[model samples]
Target: MSQTVNALEVKASPASNQTGYRSFELGSFAFSRDEYFAKVTWHVGGQKLSHVMSADAFLRAMMRDVAWGFFYGWVNFDPVIGTRNLYGKVELYAGAYHPAYKEKGLDLTETFDSREIMATFKAILDDWTNEGFDPFAAPDETDTTWVGKKNGNNRLAIERQRQACKRMPGLAGDAELRTDKNGYPVNRAFADVSQEEPEVHAEPGFEDEVHAFSLFAYLSRSDVTWNPSVSSVLERSLCCPTTEEYILPIKHGNDRVEWFIQLSDQIEWEIEDKQTGAPRAKVIMKAGDVAAMPADIRHQGYSKKRSMLLVWENATPGLPELYESGKLKPNPVEF
Candidate 1:
């Protein structure tokens, strides 16, 4: 039996504000609707980029950004809740979809089509400009404060689990650390790659803090099962209420591999490396944005005026168990 998939259908119309933006179809089914969304940011080198994508386009772009190294973020409207939103999630593969992959690497043809991806992206932009929605006017902060604290609790539990797992024998391996062209520590862990490059920092007084949690889950693509676990230990970690701050230090051979799952409305920040004295990069994240930082990279947290996030992690086997032991570091930073 053949399985049915949704088709790409789009309709573009001039926006009511006369700003030259257009409205587009939001979803393939009747219950779905398009909402206003925007992603704008400036990199450390001073390059500006922006994109207006629907929720779906925002996801795909984020996937691409993690696969290829680039500044990709977004701000979106949630019609169901009547609010503007912000979010960020890390992509594990920094070069997941490189040109080299087209001929010599993972075959994405069966899983993703360029045309469909573009259609989704266009629809998001069109809906924002023409749908009479605002991406900045979120609800009052007081109404959403409780949800934020709840998410913080969830984040903390996941990190404690990872800290415990680090102690098991055979859980630690050479693969945990990212190596350079000559095979040296690339900023302690693979997650820190973005921090070493001068082009990925944030604003002044904003230092980057690592998300101690790691995120690893399965997204069923049309062709294959994308599993990050085969390569690294930290599989899927969530960033909800339990986590506050994470630190990814310069590699000295004793760092752990950590990742973060940035759920809806939570903000992950970026900034310059304090030790290196590099200039900061500009970050503009909207609702539905996902980005990843290497272990050495620094990032912080930005909560929505009202909302919750689910962060996931996949850590080296014995690390989680170690946190339960007395050896775990005290008062780890929160994001």
Candidate 2:
């Protein structure tokens, strides 16, 4: 059974009231829309596979999977299909075992009816080839902007700024500001490093009193556990947090370096070679420890207690090309 089947069976139209709903009308197949999900029945190689999944999830997954396929030369559909349970195993039997099954990755032929899916993914590849998008970037940034801020395309690709976490205090040096019990601004709140005035003195220059500021205070303030919240953004790089009991998902195979600072507690990370899926390293980061992840790896983290994790990312636009072209070393500080 040739895996070349047209699986997108366009059937129905969704109501107009649903917000942010889009039907796939790209390539030879159009979407068969429903109220909340997409019902696509693709006919490939004289076989039919019907899959119904949430519209938003499907689109996000498809785009991410296709993008991964472009960069890594393969994509895993089993994680998507197995977790989502949209299409049954029997429906995908014909396309499951393919010669192009490059790695232990999922079979992409299991989704599409024809080879046109390749073309769609290729379109995504074209962007990364030049004006590339960073899929592993935070939700606030995903698409690579080809033009300046004035471009409408750039506006469309923008993400909503996160509001939940703590913002950075514009202090050039540590202990520069002082605070009272009520977090009120004052001149002399604490002693400085000089230790002449008192045990804790204000950092030089002009000191200002702050109401209250502490890492323990910040970690205590967060009630939600396990989910990452953005804490601060320093230019294009910033730290987001995860108050974790378990671990975070390895979203996309990142093609660039990302730094991790264990602000408090510990996290055990299992890093694997991105392309080959081989174990590269196992690391344990304790409090105040920092680790830099290289581009050629995929990693996941586990924490025993509800711990604080500071995820630092480099949002430099041209970094991907720099690393891919061997212009920059994967390790920022070369030993």
TM-score of 2: 0.47
For candidate 2, the 10 contiguous residues with the lowest summed lDDT are 82-91
Alpha carbon lDDT of residue 58, candidate 1?
38
lDDT per residue (tens digit) for residues 1-335 in model 1: 11112465544444435333343432211112223333322122243322233443332232222221122111111111110011122112111223342234431211223344344443432233222221111222012221111111111111111112222111333223222432322221123223231243646654333112122111110011011222223344422222211211111111122334443334445543322213355343444554433323223344432222233343345542354353554224446
| Candidate 2 regions with alpha-carbon error over 4 angstroms | 1-100, 103-161, 164-212, 223-227
Error of 1 at 275 (Å): 3.7
Q: Which stretches of candidate 1 lie over 4 Å from their true place?
A: 1-257, 266-268, 277-284, 304-306, 317-335
Residue 48 lDDT, candidate 2, scale 0-100: 50
- How far out, in Å, is residue 112 in model 1? 51
Task: Give lDDT per model, in order.
Answer: 0.27, 0.44
| Candidate 1, RMSD to the unseen true structure | 22.1
Provide the lDDT at 41 for model 2: 50
